[model samples]
Target: MSIQSFKFSLQTLRKEGGISQLSYGIRVFIALCGAMALSWGINQIDMVIPLFLGIIASALAETEDGWQGRVRALLITLVLFIITAFGVRLLMPYPWVFGISIALVAFCLSMCGALGRRYGVMAQATLILAVYTMIGLNQATHEMPIWYEPVLLSFGALWYGILSVIWAALFAHVTLRQALTSLYIEIGLYLKLKSKFFPLPTRGAVDSLRLDLAQQHGQVVVALNRVREILVSRIDSNPTNPRLGRYIRFYFIAQGIHERASSSHYNYSDLAETFFHSDILFRLQRQLSEAGTSCRKIGEAIHGGHAIDLRDSEETVAGVLRSIDYLEREAEPTQWRLFRSLRQLTDNVIALQQELDKARQLEDISLSDASQQIPQPRVTFRSILSQIADQLTPKSQVFRHAVRMSLALSCGYAIIQNMNLSVGYWVMLTTLFVCLPTFGSTRKRLYERIAGTVIGLVAAWALITLFPVEVIQLVIAVTAGVVFFLSRNNRYVLATAAITLMVVCCFNQVSDGYDVIWPRLIDTLIGSIISWLAVFFILPDWSHRQLPMTFAEGLRRSADYLRELMRFYQEDNVSEQVYRHSRRRAYNADALLTSTLVSMQQEPGHFRRDTELWQRLVIRSHTLFNYIAAFSAHRGTLIEQPSNQLLADAGNYIVESLQEVAQCLEQKQLVTDSSAEFERLRNTLEDCPSDDDERHYFVQSQLQSLLGQLEEIRRLTLELQVQVHGEHIKDVK
Candidate 1:
């Protein structure tokens, strides 16, 4: 990884002391202290029951929900945890019965993530509950009745659940602001990464920058989604909520700024060739870098709740504009088109700065004046259930993973039971944690887990040998638990190591820890091997099988956005609600494709036989979305609505062509070139009245530019189809 990438990864892991981090840390500390106090107060440190409950509750409390939702969800999970704990004990005497039952439960719980993020969290918590219960069974003593442990576990879970709700009630706004701050941080990083793509610094740098850009863009999309989810939930519950209205508007401004900031004006390679030695190109690069720095400053200010200096970015924009003017005059006649492109790029940067200014001023606006509803998908119980049903199919990736996990875990359980290893549950536990959705991820996790485990074991051994103090060991265990919670998402290897140390520490609280090390390592190896074998042999669904459908879905959504734009243009009374919804869907689809393509890259090389082609298709689809966004922005700015007959007709034709492209991709049909209709649309643009209204002329010019972009989309899609279908069709135009 580059230094910048490493820094980005580190920042993501540490969370940089935002309000969210503070809240999370507080909650974790509360859980720890509460659990430890109760355990000591009751004088039952043998079971370490409080520790289990506290850890489970703290881990599962990562829900972006309101107080009511968090409480309700936590209660539901508690019930499930109790049931699993008792049920596992009841079936422990019958190894075969227990194995099969556990396998089925694992399958169902793992598949729950297919529903949505909330359900995904529930699924993971349930899985952890199951593992915790099984481990308890392995350590079960004849002194305690079966119900005793289950009931005690439920108390721990309930206590943590109550604490979570209290935290939510007290710091809901802090959580929301923290989420928004994260979105801004990612946007800043994305902008900074994008700045590196300019001036085509070098061939080597270009590829690295592009990869970083793609990664950062994906992160930005994920952050934006979370922010939108939180805001939408608030607004949906109360549409006229003033605070939500202001925040939603601010989010929209950031979204708009990001759209413009990341939009591709011209090919970077083309820019390198056209203005290789031009001082203006370097000036533009510096301006972009400064803009990115300004974005980071704004993010920091937001995170810290401090005042922002808006004039700094404005001055940078002014300097960039002056540089553009100087270059425009210095350019020879041959460089006029290149100069125009450079000016347009600078204009986008300036627009982004203006949006940033507006965002900073958003606090002054009244809620009644801002858009009330946040753009998002309908998130209801019914919708989530329907999503679950839709994915419960043989073709679904989630289904395949669920089945794979069930089989792998069952095998691990059988091996452990038959061998009668001292810590047999560790084998199943390692298998459960190592197995991921994709084969590539599973393999990658295997390496990380093994390395992390060895390092953690060595660290634990050294600490115990050197200090040999119970209090210090307990503190180390608690610290490991805290770090595990904070670092799991961005630093999985570190989390694994910390969690391993935590488990060892907890074990030491009850029994001898001296003999646990070698067994843990051996069991981990067995589990990792089982997981790999199962994923590779059992109904493995490679990403190659799903890429076409994802590509088609992206194209279909782009077409929908185009049709919405046409409606907005023709009606001349654009409903912000409808336009925003369509745009959101399009952007979501693009993000989905980008994420899938990145996953596809991680799959086995043989499965990615046409990796280059798939990448081009994704790049083309992204470019298509950018053009559609530009069209939307340009159309929104027109003072006098241009005659929409030609534009509407053109939009309809383009939509139809895009739909055909999607169908061709999905059905493996030959792609027919749609250049003729695009040309006709261009020809019809001449009919737009070139009167004194400069805005009208600007709209005309934008439409012309949009058409050219559409033509590029058509060409790229046809090329992709030809590559996939292995057949080329003669051009009709």
Candidate 2:
């Protein structure tokens, strides 16, 4: 192959493997420099080895994302560490004295995870590394004392942490850019699909939320309000920065799409009327053209007085082109059904664009006030559990996905480990392979493992030839830097490869780095195969099924927690306490929702449960939670009792229906129809005569609305089961 062809093929291979191999050469150069500095710094007689605490510091201080920030990351990391650590630790027994000491350390960490948030996650990971790494490294015949190991490990961790902070702050732009691009792509996809029918076997009849039929329009106002906030700030950022512009425009389009789609979800056959016609399509085209042009002009304005030349921002240009493409596609004779919805979407986009301008000005004026507006608190325990239920990022389900490949990962890992070929890469590759949120995780794990291994070999060959083995110190420094970069992403594959490359290089350097490349490359291939087998066979992640169960659990738990909270509120002289279990409940609830959203993309089958009836329920639950929180916040000035019978009735209905839903799910009899008497009561309950006359005297004034709500929900429960499960409801006679 030509040198240019070889290089091009190698680059493509690395990217396909998700290895970021192109970054290796640069890293090696930096490492060589760092080695020179570090060697000199250490060579000075009696000099104290500099503690590289940057990684630790960065991990600690990172993320302005609130609560779920460091804490969640830390928890997952710790869990991963324990799994690995325990696997090896069982090979030998520690002295009782050391065991006791470790137990104390473990206890302290268990308490920290309970504290929750960024701290919990970060601390758990650190402590796990601290504990397990200490044990693992000690297997060396000339082991350092436990105390010394912790100290040294801390220094190492700290150094890496600093690198992480620097990497995340500076180069995290790459990931952010990709995310922005994805947002746009997702938007375009949503529009295209929504333009068509829902693809149900029965096409003419639509299957949407019964509740949606009641309040679809109610949603547009709320969604537009939220979308406007992110939309304006994003579009108003520096447009000259391509990375920033890409992200901002992506955000604008996604928010606009969401607002547009939500209007459809809420309104009846709004899709048929808005999308299935031609005049509306033309109208939509005119509106979007105006809006897109205005947006392009505004973007130019942000590009520092650069006249609106139209070619500066690729992202802006691309967004405009996409808008045009969508419009053109709509103008086609075939997409008439989309015409109606497209026009409504056009109107929302226009309105939201105006709102964006207003929000931008208001944002500046409200900056200080906004800062004080109680940034979202740490995700409660309930939210966290909820996330688990929702299978937000079912990293664990990497097993049980695809059979052919899962067998491959298991067989691969077992064989490579038996062969003793530095199976660390295999372990890591397996981790990555199982993370396909939307794709088949099992297949991805095997595919990525092979791809990464091949890329690593090629990258190593190139980088090793460029830097001599004597530059060992440089290799370490550069590897450290790359590791810093890796921590910026959740996947951490690229950084892991960087660290792996250095270790492999370390083994090579010790052998005078004079070895031919063929043997090492072949070994890497073997290890890669092992990784594929481990993920595909032993621990294949069945991502699709996990999301549904996880989400359902979170919803059930959230409802249970709310019921408990209400019970607590009703008792007089009782202290309003957020108990530990209740806190767990809350954290799980939020976590589940976040996970639900995350996993929805990864596993389609599982996610379908959420998109259907559950969406209506979850969203309504969110409203209930918000209202409850608001009520609790101002408990002192609250009404002596809820005077609104309808409101109280709605609340009761929600509580009861949710309780039944939970039981139905738990019993695995989710399709069971509502009992005949309850069905009659539900019908009677819906028609609240005189908005009060309130057989109302029969209900608790504070809970009358809740009761009414429960009845309506009971009716909905039956309808949804029929809709979602295709279970026939027996005659209510």
- Candidate 2 TM-score over all chains jointly: 0.49
Candidate 1 global CA lDDT score: 0.71
Give the Cα lDDT of each candidate: 0.71, 0.39
Candidate 1 lDDT for residue 67: 76
Q: Which residue pairs collide, candidate 1?
A: none
Runs of candidate 1 with Cα error greater than 4 angstroms are 1-22, 196-212, 234-246, 265-283, 321-347, 364-371, 375-384, 637-644, 674-733
RMSD of each: 4.0, 12.8
TM-score of 1: 0.88
lDDT of 2 by residue, 281-394 (tens): 344333333333333343323322333332322333345346545756646665543333343344344444443343223212222322222123445778756644443232
Q: Whole-model lDDT for model 2 versus the true structure?
A: 0.39
